[model samples]
Target: MNIKLIVLFFSLYCLFFVASILFPIDFNWYNSLHKPSYTPSGKTIGIIWAFLYSFISLSVCIVVSMVESFKKAKWFFILFIINYIFNQLFSFFQFEQKNILLATIDCGFVSVTAILLAITAYKHSKTSFILLIPYSLWSIFATYLNYNIYLLNI
Candidate 1:
């Protein structure tokens, strides 16, 4: 693996963490909300996100290193950008704005985009696709969780 590419992928992954910090979940506010019984604690959430980000970074590194064509690479990069946007949007809605409805919608978009990104990565590298499956699954679960919260609180 190219060290520079790995660094680049990891750097991009770190931006997601930065976004989370910029729009952090207010634990007091969150606790006050009517959350689902299935909701995990903040510590659990942090650990899961750490694993997910590591997997996502690895997948991105594989896809970037294995892409055979510029066209395929372009599509992969575009999908990644879109997915990141939705990811940040989810945080902005859920934590910063406290808009559960918008957050649920954003989570839905994140899930869909994650699946699409996995599919796109699959074309270039199976390892990349496989690595991304957990993140995609987590995104889907998060979408459901967010939607449930919206329904319950409404």
Candidate 2:
């Protein structure tokens, strides 16, 4: 694809994250009460998300640019997008009704998808791989948060 397509793709990626934050959607009803042992404040979350999103955008650019021979690798990007969409849904179910099990499952899927994507990206582009580093680490951290929330709520 062209650079325009790649840029559009990355812009769309950040747009979704922005959409998620703009809404008052919560991830879990239990999350409101259960404090994470290492939960950062809202400000911290914003900063971290901004950084992660930047990394994700660059990695996505590389992925999109490499979409020819790496057609199979495209699944990694697809999964990444799917995870974000599902994550929003997960947050809806979690905050709307406190569905811990379902939310936990969603988190698990997202965590796994991100890790797998990270590996694929690493194998393809060194710059993209480096970009994915923080995202992978954060996914792991989010998994912990999701699991703990489930444990505390259930």
Candidate 3:
């Protein structure tokens, strides 16, 4: 395992924490909205995201570390970067901007990129691919939740 790559990937993922801080969820507004029946509690959502982020970071680290050169890691880098941006933007769209529609759209993008990232990871590192499964599944589930929220509140 590459400790440097692990640290770099994990540190990049840590920015999600910063994004959360910057776009703190407004409980009052969120609570006032009509949420779907299966919407997880905020604490549960937080816990799930924590797990997902760790797995995702580690998965990326594994894939990138296994690659002998940056050229070989280019696809992983592209997919991961796209996924990271969309992942981080969810808080900004849903919490800060308070836009259910935009957030729903963002969730779809996140899910797509996550699946792509996982598929791409499989060729380089099966461990990385397996690690990404939960993230991919969760993103799809989250997309469902977000879409329902949009429908319920619209």
Candidate 4:
């Protein structure tokens, strides 16, 4: 495996990482909201996202390494890019903009794109697909949580 390619792929994921920092959660506003009893603590959510991002970075690296040509990885690439955009925007919508409804809608897009990216990566590398499974599941769960938050807040 090419270590440089792996680094490059992982670097691509930094966009969302940077966004999360830029749009750091506002605990004051967040704590004010009516959240579900099962809503995870901020620290728990942070830990989960850290793992998810690592998996996503590793999965993209695997797919990039296994594919013979860029064409083979194009769909996976496109889907992941879309997923990243939606993922990053969630912080902007939820924390920066403070719009739970928009955040909830963005979560749906993030979940759909994550699932599609995982499925698209399967043919190239099963390991990569497996790595993305948690990401897909997490995104879906996040969507559910966001939807509930929106409902409770409204």
Q: How do the predictions measure up, each by TM-score? A: 0.94, 0.77, 0.94, 0.94
Which residue pairs in candidate 1 have backbone atoms (N, alpha carbon, C) closer than 3 angstroms, thus clashing?
none
Which segments of candidate 2 are over 4 A away from where they belong? Answer: 1-6, 18-23, 26-32, 69-72
Give the per-residue lDDT of model 1 (tens digit) for 9-40.
77967887977889988888888888788998
Better of 1 and 4 by TM-score: 4
Q: Which ten residues in a row have the lowest lDDT in candidate 3?
A: 1-10
Error of 4 at 67 (Å): 1.0
Candidate 4 regions with alpha-carbon error over 4 angstroms:
none
TM-score of model 2 vs. true structure: 0.77
lDDT pick, better of 1 and 2:
1
Residue 106 error, candidate 4, Å: 0.2
Reference-based lDDT, residue 151, model 3: 92
Predicted candidate 3 versus true structure: per-residue lDDT over 1-154, tens digit per residue:
6579867777967966877888998999999999878889989999998988888877877876788997897988899988988988999999999999999899999999999999999989999999999999999999999899889887
lDDT of each: 0.87, 0.71, 0.88, 0.89
Q: Local error of candidate 1 at 70, Å?
A: 3.6
Q: Model 4 over residues 46-149: C-alpha lDDT tens digits? A: 89988888888888888877888889788888898888889989999999999999999999999999999999989899999999999999999999999999
Candidate 3's C-alpha runs over 4 A off are none
TM-score of 3: 0.94
Clashes of 4: 0
Q: Top TM-score: which candidate number?
A: 4
